[model samples]
Target: DNIRLSIFVPIRDGLCNWKLQMVCKTDNIPDKERTAVFELNEGVLGYTFLKTRKHQIEFIDVSNNNNLPSTYVSLNSDNSNLINRDIKGVLVVSAFQNGSVAGLLAIDTENVSDLSKMEDNKLHSDALDWIIARSKAVKWIWRIKNNV
Candidate 1:
Protein backbone atom coordinates (compact mmCIF):
# COMPACT_ATOMS: atom_id res chain seq x y z
CA ASP A 1 0.00 0.00 0.00
CA ASN A 2 2.99 2.32 0.33
CA ILE A 3 1.62 3.80 3.54
CA ARG A 4 3.71 6.69 4.86
CA LEU A 5 4.08 5.55 8.43
CA SER A 6 5.60 8.04 10.90
CA ILE A 7 8.17 6.31 13.05
CA PHE A 8 8.27 7.37 16.70
CA VAL A 9 11.01 6.59 19.18
CA PRO A 10 10.59 6.11 22.92
CA ILE A 11 12.05 8.92 24.96
CA ARG A 12 13.59 8.90 28.46
CA ASP A 13 10.15 9.70 29.87
CA GLY A 14 9.15 6.13 28.93
CA LEU A 15 6.63 7.66 26.56
CA CYS A 16 6.64 7.08 22.86
CA ASN A 17 7.37 10.58 21.57
CA TRP A 18 6.57 11.54 18.03
CA LYS A 19 9.63 12.32 15.93
CA LEU A 20 9.30 15.90 14.85
CA GLN A 21 11.58 15.44 11.89
CA MET A 22 9.30 12.85 10.36
CA VAL A 23 6.11 14.88 10.74
CA CYS A 24 6.94 16.97 7.69
CA LYS A 25 6.82 13.92 5.45
CA THR A 26 3.32 13.03 6.64
CA ASP A 27 0.34 13.86 4.47
CA ASN A 28 -1.66 15.68 7.18
CA ILE A 29 -4.92 14.78 5.52
CA PRO A 30 -7.90 17.05 6.28
CA ASP A 31 -5.45 19.86 7.17
CA LYS A 32 -4.21 20.78 10.65
CA GLU A 33 -1.47 22.62 12.47
CA ARG A 34 1.72 21.93 10.61
CA THR A 35 3.75 22.39 13.79
CA ALA A 36 1.67 20.22 16.10
CA VAL A 37 3.07 17.07 17.62
CA PHE A 38 0.86 14.39 19.15
CA GLU A 39 0.37 14.67 22.90
CA LEU A 40 -0.45 11.34 24.62
CA ASN A 41 -0.42 12.36 28.22
CA GLU A 42 -3.84 12.21 30.06
CA GLY A 43 -5.47 12.38 26.63
CA VAL A 44 -7.80 9.53 25.67
CA LEU A 45 -6.44 9.23 22.16
CA GLY A 46 -3.07 8.45 23.67
CA TYR A 47 -4.63 6.26 26.33
CA THR A 48 -6.52 4.20 23.79
CA PHE A 49 -3.76 3.89 21.25
CA LEU A 50 -0.73 3.82 23.55
CA LYS A 51 -2.11 2.14 26.66
CA THR A 52 -4.84 -0.24 25.49
CA ARG A 53 -2.61 -0.93 22.50
CA LYS A 54 -5.39 -1.30 19.97
CA HIS A 55 -7.05 0.39 17.05
CA GLN A 56 -9.17 3.35 18.21
CA ILE A 57 -11.02 6.36 16.87
CA GLU A 58 -11.66 9.23 19.24
CA PHE A 59 -13.61 12.47 18.91
CA ILE A 60 -13.15 15.78 20.73
CA ASP A 61 -13.91 14.60 24.23
CA VAL A 62 -11.10 12.42 25.55
CA SER A 63 -12.79 10.95 28.60
CA ASN A 64 -16.02 9.50 27.28
CA ASN A 65 -14.91 5.89 27.73
CA ASN A 66 -14.31 4.35 31.16
CA ASN A 67 -11.90 1.78 29.76
CA LEU A 68 -9.28 4.45 29.19
CA PRO A 69 -6.10 3.86 31.12
CA SER A 70 -6.11 5.51 34.54
CA THR A 71 -2.45 6.31 34.28
CA TYR A 72 -2.92 7.98 30.95
CA VAL A 73 -5.86 9.97 32.27
CA SER A 74 -4.01 11.13 35.34
CA LEU A 75 -0.99 12.04 33.31
CA ASN A 76 -2.80 13.70 30.41
CA SER A 77 -6.25 15.08 31.12
CA ASP A 78 -8.94 15.93 28.58
CA ASN A 79 -8.17 19.59 29.11
CA SER A 80 -4.42 19.08 29.10
CA ASN A 81 -2.21 18.77 26.08
CA LEU A 82 -5.05 18.35 23.61
CA ILE A 83 -4.58 16.43 20.39
CA ASN A 84 -4.02 18.18 17.04
CA ARG A 85 -3.11 21.31 18.96
CA ASP A 86 -6.43 21.51 20.76
CA ILE A 87 -8.65 21.57 17.72
CA LYS A 88 -12.33 21.46 18.67
CA GLY A 89 -13.63 18.73 16.36
CA VAL A 90 -10.84 16.34 15.56
CA LEU A 91 -11.10 12.73 14.44
CA VAL A 92 -8.11 10.52 15.11
CA VAL A 93 -7.24 6.86 14.69
CA SER A 94 -4.14 5.04 15.80
CA ALA A 95 -2.76 1.91 14.21
CA PHE A 96 -0.57 -0.15 16.52
CA GLN A 97 0.74 -3.64 15.87
CA ASN A 98 3.46 -6.06 17.00
CA GLY A 99 3.35 -4.35 20.40
CA SER A 100 4.36 -0.97 18.98
CA VAL A 101 2.60 1.94 17.29
CA ALA A 102 3.60 2.65 13.73
CA GLY A 103 1.63 5.84 13.06
CA LEU A 104 -1.64 7.73 13.44
CA LEU A 105 -4.33 8.65 10.89
CA ALA A 106 -6.16 11.86 11.70
CA ILE A 107 -8.45 14.51 10.24
CA ASP A 108 -9.69 17.94 11.33
CA THR A 109 -13.39 18.46 10.74
CA GLU A 110 -16.54 19.91 12.20
CA ASN A 111 -18.67 17.87 14.62
CA VAL A 112 -19.24 14.69 12.67
CA SER A 113 -22.89 13.60 12.81
CA ASP A 114 -21.71 9.99 12.95
CA LEU A 115 -18.45 8.22 13.74
CA SER A 116 -18.97 6.33 10.51
CA LYS A 117 -18.38 9.63 8.77
CA MET A 118 -14.76 9.43 9.80
CA GLU A 119 -14.42 5.73 9.05
CA ASP A 120 -16.17 5.93 5.70
CA ASN A 121 -14.09 8.80 4.41
CA LYS A 122 -11.85 7.45 1.67
CA LEU A 123 -8.71 9.28 2.77
CA HIS A 124 -9.19 8.37 6.45
CA SER A 125 -10.12 4.74 5.80
CA ASP A 126 -7.29 4.17 3.36
CA ALA A 127 -4.72 5.55 5.80
CA LEU A 128 -5.94 3.35 8.66
CA ASP A 129 -6.27 0.24 6.51
CA TRP A 130 -2.89 0.82 4.99
CA ILE A 131 -1.24 1.19 8.38
CA ILE A 132 -2.79 -2.05 9.66
CA ALA A 133 -1.92 -3.94 6.51
CA ARG A 134 1.61 -2.58 6.56
CA SER A 135 2.08 -3.57 10.17
CA LYS A 136 1.07 -7.13 9.34
CA ALA A 137 3.50 -7.13 6.46
CA VAL A 138 6.29 -6.03 8.80
CA LYS A 139 5.55 -8.98 11.10
CA TRP A 140 5.70 -11.43 8.23
CA ILE A 141 8.92 -9.94 6.96
CA TRP A 142 10.49 -10.18 10.40
CA ARG A 143 9.34 -13.77 10.78
CA ILE A 144 10.84 -14.74 7.47
CA LYS A 145 14.04 -12.85 8.25
CA ASN A 146 14.45 -14.80 11.47
CA ASN A 147 13.26 -18.02 9.79
CA VAL A 148 10.73 -18.45 12.59
Candidate 2:
Protein backbone atom coordinates (compact mmCIF):
# COMPACT_ATOMS: atom_id res chain seq x y z
CA ASP A 1 0.00 0.00 0.00
CA ASN A 2 1.06 3.60 -0.57
CA ILE A 3 0.13 6.91 0.94
CA ARG A 4 -0.83 9.71 -1.39
CA LEU A 5 -0.25 13.13 0.08
CA SER A 6 -0.54 16.30 -2.00
CA ILE A 7 0.78 19.61 -0.73
CA PHE A 8 0.39 23.03 -2.27
CA VAL A 9 2.48 25.96 -1.04
CA PRO A 10 1.93 29.30 -2.68
CA ILE A 11 4.98 31.43 -3.26
CA ARG A 12 4.23 34.95 -2.18
CA ASP A 13 6.02 38.03 -0.94
CA GLY A 14 4.72 37.58 2.60
CA LEU A 15 4.97 34.59 4.88
CA CYS A 16 4.97 31.40 2.78
CA ASN A 17 2.15 29.09 3.80
CA TRP A 18 2.06 25.32 3.35
CA LYS A 19 -1.09 23.26 3.63
CA LEU A 20 -2.03 19.60 3.52
CA GLN A 21 -4.38 19.74 0.58
CA MET A 22 -5.34 16.08 0.35
CA VAL A 23 -4.51 12.55 1.39
CA CYS A 24 -5.43 9.00 0.44
CA LYS A 25 -5.13 5.64 2.17
CA THR A 26 -5.02 7.26 5.61
CA ASP A 27 -7.81 8.58 7.76
CA ASN A 28 -6.13 8.99 11.13
CA ILE A 29 -4.59 12.33 10.21
CA PRO A 30 -5.23 14.72 13.05
CA ASP A 31 -7.83 17.37 12.40
CA LYS A 32 -5.26 20.07 13.03
CA GLU A 33 -3.07 18.76 10.22
CA ARG A 34 -5.95 18.78 7.78
CA THR A 35 -6.25 22.48 8.46
CA ALA A 36 -2.64 22.92 9.44
CA VAL A 37 -0.63 25.82 8.04
CA PHE A 38 3.12 26.08 7.81
CA GLU A 39 5.49 28.82 6.81
CA LEU A 40 7.40 28.26 3.55
CA ASN A 41 10.75 27.85 5.25
CA GLU A 42 9.44 25.83 8.12
CA GLY A 43 9.41 22.04 7.83
CA VAL A 44 10.06 19.34 5.31
CA LEU A 45 7.12 20.61 3.32
CA GLY A 46 8.50 24.11 3.06
CA TYR A 47 11.92 22.76 2.24
CA THR A 48 10.43 20.85 -0.66
CA PHE A 49 8.56 23.89 -1.90
CA LEU A 50 11.64 26.07 -1.94
CA LYS A 51 13.81 23.40 -3.52
CA THR A 52 11.46 22.59 -6.41
CA ARG A 53 11.88 24.13 -9.84
CA LYS A 54 10.52 27.62 -10.23
CA HIS A 55 8.85 27.21 -13.61
CA GLN A 56 9.23 23.81 -15.23
CA ILE A 57 7.89 20.69 -13.59
CA GLU A 58 10.55 18.58 -11.96
CA PHE A 59 10.20 15.34 -10.02
CA ILE A 60 12.58 14.66 -7.19
CA ASP A 61 12.79 11.96 -4.61
CA VAL A 62 13.86 13.93 -1.60
CA SER A 63 14.70 10.97 0.58
CA ASN A 64 15.35 7.34 -0.18
CA ASN A 65 17.70 6.67 2.68
CA ASN A 66 16.89 3.64 4.77
CA ASN A 67 17.33 5.53 8.03
CA LEU A 68 15.23 8.43 9.16
CA PRO A 69 16.41 11.71 7.68
CA SER A 70 16.94 14.57 10.09
CA THR A 71 15.01 16.77 7.68
CA TYR A 72 11.79 15.05 8.77
CA VAL A 73 11.87 17.06 12.00
CA SER A 74 8.58 18.89 12.38
CA LEU A 75 8.52 22.57 13.11
CA ASN A 76 5.42 22.29 15.24
CA SER A 77 6.15 21.42 18.85
CA ASP A 78 2.82 19.61 19.07
CA ASN A 79 3.95 17.31 16.27
CA SER A 80 7.09 16.33 18.12
CA ASN A 81 6.03 12.72 17.82
CA LEU A 82 7.54 12.75 14.32
CA ILE A 83 5.20 13.17 11.35
CA ASN A 84 6.96 11.44 8.48
CA ARG A 85 8.94 8.75 10.20
CA ASP A 86 10.09 5.84 8.05
CA ILE A 87 9.15 7.68 4.88
CA LYS A 88 11.01 5.83 2.15
CA GLY A 89 10.53 8.35 -0.63
CA VAL A 90 9.12 11.83 -1.15
CA LEU A 91 8.18 12.95 -4.68
CA VAL A 92 8.41 16.69 -5.19
CA VAL A 93 7.18 18.38 -8.34
CA SER A 94 6.51 21.92 -9.49
CA ALA A 95 3.13 23.26 -10.54
CA PHE A 96 2.81 26.09 -13.02
CA GLN A 97 0.19 28.39 -14.48
CA ASN A 98 0.63 31.16 -17.04
CA GLY A 99 4.42 30.77 -16.90
CA SER A 100 4.56 31.08 -13.12
CA VAL A 101 4.96 28.56 -10.37
CA ALA A 102 1.62 28.32 -8.62
CA GLY A 103 2.61 25.67 -6.13
CA LEU A 104 4.65 22.60 -5.39
CA LEU A 105 3.33 19.06 -4.93
CA ALA A 106 4.89 16.46 -2.70
CA ILE A 107 3.82 12.87 -2.27
CA ASP A 108 5.16 10.71 0.54
CA THR A 109 5.23 6.99 -0.02
CA GLU A 110 6.18 4.58 2.74
CA ASN A 111 6.54 1.64 0.42
CA VAL A 112 8.68 2.59 -2.56
CA SER A 113 8.29 -0.83 -4.09
CA ASP A 114 4.56 -0.37 -4.31
CA LEU A 115 5.05 2.88 -6.17
CA SER A 116 7.58 1.28 -8.48
CA LYS A 117 5.18 -1.51 -9.29
CA MET A 118 2.45 0.99 -10.02
CA GLU A 119 4.77 2.92 -12.27
CA ASP A 120 5.39 -0.30 -14.17
CA ASN A 121 1.69 -0.74 -14.80
CA LYS A 122 0.66 1.15 -17.93
CA LEU A 123 -2.68 2.27 -16.57
CA HIS A 124 -1.24 3.41 -13.28
CA SER A 125 1.65 5.13 -14.99
CA ASP A 126 -0.73 6.90 -17.36
CA ALA A 127 -2.79 8.09 -14.45
CA LEU A 128 0.34 9.34 -12.76
CA ASP A 129 1.34 11.20 -15.92
CA TRP A 130 -2.11 12.74 -16.18
CA ILE A 131 -1.81 13.96 -12.62
CA ILE A 132 1.57 15.53 -13.33
CA ALA A 133 0.33 17.17 -16.49
CA ARG A 134 -2.64 18.56 -14.64
CA SER A 135 -0.38 19.94 -11.95
CA LYS A 136 1.49 21.97 -14.52
CA ALA A 137 -1.70 23.38 -15.96
CA VAL A 138 -2.96 24.90 -12.73
CA LYS A 139 -4.65 28.27 -13.22
CA TRP A 140 -4.58 30.50 -10.17
CA ILE A 141 -7.31 33.13 -10.41
CA TRP A 142 -7.38 34.02 -6.74
CA ARG A 143 -5.08 37.00 -7.30
CA ILE A 144 -6.38 39.93 -9.24
CA LYS A 145 -4.48 40.76 -12.38
CA ASN A 146 -1.67 43.20 -11.57
CA ASN A 147 -3.05 43.14 -8.02
CA VAL A 148 -5.67 45.64 -9.17
Candidate 3:
Protein backbone atom coordinates (compact mmCIF):
# COMPACT_ATOMS: atom_id res chain seq x y z
CA ASP A 1 0.00 0.00 0.00
CA ASN A 2 1.14 3.53 -0.77
CA ILE A 3 0.11 6.94 0.40
CA ARG A 4 -1.25 9.40 -2.13
CA LEU A 5 -0.20 12.98 -2.60
CA SER A 6 -2.47 15.62 -4.09
CA ILE A 7 -1.13 18.78 -5.62
CA PHE A 8 -3.51 21.59 -6.54
CA VAL A 9 -2.55 24.54 -8.68
CA PRO A 10 -4.83 27.42 -9.53
CA ILE A 11 -3.85 29.79 -12.30
CA ARG A 12 -5.41 33.16 -12.98
CA ASP A 13 -4.84 36.35 -14.93
CA GLY A 14 -5.57 39.85 -13.60
CA LEU A 15 -9.18 39.26 -12.73
CA CYS A 16 -10.17 37.73 -9.43
CA ASN A 17 -11.07 34.38 -10.92
CA TRP A 18 -9.28 31.06 -10.81
CA LYS A 19 -9.35 27.69 -12.49
CA LEU A 20 -8.31 24.64 -10.53
CA GLN A 21 -5.81 22.05 -11.72
CA MET A 22 -5.19 18.95 -9.68
CA VAL A 23 -2.57 16.22 -9.84
CA CYS A 24 -2.42 13.08 -7.75
CA LYS A 25 0.58 10.83 -7.28
CA THR A 26 0.92 7.64 -5.28
CA ASP A 27 4.37 6.21 -5.97
CA ASN A 28 6.34 7.94 -3.23
CA ILE A 29 4.92 6.30 -0.19
CA PRO A 30 5.79 2.95 1.33
CA ASP A 31 2.94 2.82 3.84
CA LYS A 32 -0.69 3.10 2.89
CA GLU A 33 -2.32 3.90 6.22
CA ARG A 34 0.04 6.67 7.26
CA THR A 35 -1.15 10.01 5.96
CA ALA A 36 -1.83 11.79 2.72
CA VAL A 37 -0.02 15.03 1.99
CA PHE A 38 -1.40 18.03 0.14
CA GLU A 39 0.90 20.87 -0.82
CA LEU A 40 -0.47 24.21 -2.05
CA ASN A 41 1.97 26.60 -3.67
CA GLU A 42 -0.12 29.67 -4.35
CA GLY A 43 0.83 33.01 -5.82
CA VAL A 44 -2.37 34.87 -5.08
CA LEU A 45 -2.56 38.52 -6.08
CA GLY A 46 -5.89 39.19 -4.45
CA TYR A 47 -9.13 37.59 -3.44
CA THR A 48 -12.78 38.67 -3.51
CA PHE A 49 -15.69 37.07 -1.74
CA LEU A 50 -18.60 36.31 -3.99
CA LYS A 51 -22.17 36.30 -2.69
CA THR A 52 -23.19 36.90 0.89
CA ARG A 53 -23.89 33.36 1.87
CA LYS A 54 -23.63 32.05 5.41
CA HIS A 55 -21.81 28.84 4.55
CA GLN A 56 -19.60 27.76 1.66
CA ILE A 57 -19.09 31.02 -0.21
CA GLU A 58 -17.01 31.35 -3.31
CA PHE A 59 -13.65 33.03 -3.35
CA ILE A 60 -12.58 34.62 -6.60
CA ASP A 61 -8.92 35.40 -6.92
CA VAL A 62 -6.16 35.78 -9.48
CA SER A 63 -3.21 33.76 -8.32
CA ASN A 64 -0.47 35.20 -10.50
CA ASN A 65 1.42 37.18 -7.91
CA ASN A 66 1.94 36.05 -4.34
CA ASN A 67 0.32 38.69 -2.20
CA LEU A 68 -1.99 36.77 0.09
CA PRO A 69 -1.52 33.84 2.39
CA SER A 70 -3.26 30.59 1.63
CA THR A 71 -6.03 30.04 4.15
CA TYR A 72 -8.20 27.16 5.26
CA VAL A 73 -11.82 27.95 6.00
CA SER A 74 -13.95 25.39 7.76
CA LEU A 75 -17.40 24.67 6.38
CA ASN A 76 -18.77 22.66 9.26
CA SER A 77 -20.84 24.82 11.55
CA ASP A 78 -24.24 24.52 13.18
CA ASN A 79 -25.51 27.39 11.01
CA SER A 80 -24.05 25.75 7.89
CA ASN A 81 -21.79 28.68 7.17
CA LEU A 82 -18.22 28.54 6.02
CA ILE A 83 -16.48 30.47 8.74
CA ASN A 84 -12.83 30.57 9.72
CA ARG A 85 -12.19 27.91 12.30
CA ASP A 86 -9.34 26.18 14.09
CA ILE A 87 -9.24 23.00 12.06
CA LYS A 88 -5.58 22.19 11.56
CA GLY A 89 -3.76 19.82 9.14
CA VAL A 90 -3.19 21.98 6.07
CA LEU A 91 -0.03 23.57 4.66
CA VAL A 92 -0.04 26.73 2.52
CA VAL A 93 2.95 28.16 0.68
CA SER A 94 2.90 31.59 -0.91
CA ALA A 95 5.75 32.53 -3.21
CA PHE A 96 6.42 35.97 -4.62
CA GLN A 97 8.28 36.88 -7.79
CA ASN A 98 10.68 39.12 -5.92
CA GLY A 99 12.14 36.07 -4.13
CA SER A 100 10.08 36.01 -1.00
CA VAL A 101 7.79 33.40 0.54
CA ALA A 102 5.28 33.08 3.34
CA GLY A 103 3.47 30.06 4.64
CA LEU A 104 1.43 28.42 7.36
CA LEU A 105 3.45 25.37 8.27
CA ALA A 106 2.03 23.57 11.28
CA ILE A 107 -1.59 24.47 11.89
CA ASP A 108 -2.41 23.08 15.32
CA THR A 109 -5.95 24.28 15.69
CA GLU A 110 -6.24 22.81 19.14
CA ASN A 111 -3.36 24.90 20.41
CA VAL A 112 -3.90 27.84 18.10
CA SER A 113 -7.41 28.94 18.86
CA ASP A 114 -7.28 32.08 16.72
CA LEU A 115 -5.98 33.35 13.42
CA SER A 116 -3.47 35.60 15.08
CA LYS A 117 -1.61 32.61 16.50
CA MET A 118 -1.07 31.23 13.01
CA GLU A 119 0.92 34.28 12.00
CA ASP A 120 4.47 33.50 12.94
CA ASN A 121 7.65 35.05 11.55
CA LYS A 122 9.62 31.81 11.80
CA LEU A 123 7.25 29.97 9.52
CA HIS A 124 7.54 32.75 6.97
CA SER A 125 11.30 32.48 6.96
CA ASP A 126 11.17 28.73 6.36
CA ALA A 127 8.67 29.18 3.58
CA LEU A 128 10.91 31.75 1.92
CA ASP A 129 13.73 29.25 1.77
CA TRP A 130 11.48 26.57 0.36
CA ILE A 131 10.19 28.93 -2.33
CA ILE A 132 13.67 30.03 -3.29
CA ALA A 133 14.76 26.44 -3.72
CA ARG A 134 11.75 25.69 -5.87
CA SER A 135 12.33 28.80 -7.97
CA LYS A 136 15.84 27.70 -8.69
CA ALA A 137 14.67 24.25 -9.72
CA VAL A 138 12.06 25.76 -12.01
CA LYS A 139 14.65 27.95 -13.68
CA TRP A 140 16.87 24.96 -14.25
CA ILE A 141 14.02 23.04 -15.82
CA TRP A 142 13.16 25.97 -18.06
CA ARG A 143 16.72 26.13 -19.27
CA ILE A 144 16.61 22.44 -20.03
CA LYS A 145 13.39 22.89 -21.95
CA ASN A 146 14.91 25.70 -24.00
CA ASN A 147 17.98 23.64 -24.80
CA VAL A 148 15.85 20.75 -26.02
Q: TM-scores for all candidates?
A: 0.43, 0.51, 0.31
Ten contiguous residues minimizing lDDT sum, candidate 2: 139-148
Q: Report RMSD for candidate 3.
A: 12.3
Instruction: Kindly report which residue stretches of model 1 are placed more than 4 angstroms away from their true locations once superposed.
Output: 1-32, 42-44, 61-86, 111-116, 119-127, 134-148
* Cα displacement (Å) at residue 52, model 3: 23
Better of 1 and 2 by TM-score: 2
Question: Residue 69's C-alpha lDDT in candidate 2?
Answer: 46
Q: Write the per-residue lDDT of candidate 1 for residues 1-148, one digit (tens) a residue.
A: 1122232222222344332111323463222333333355434345445543466555443223453334644423433343333233335556555655544544444333443444456756665676577665544433443344
What is the Cα-based TM-score of model 1? 0.43
lDDT string for model 2 (10-96, tens) is 533435533433232245444455444456554555555555454333232434433434554345764434355555555555555
> How many steric clashes between backbone atoms does each model show?
4, 0, 3
Q: Could you arrange the candidates by TM-score from highest to lowest?
A: 2, 1, 3
Show pairs that collide, candidate 2.
none
| Poorest lDDT segment (10 consecutive residues) of candidate 3 | 43-52
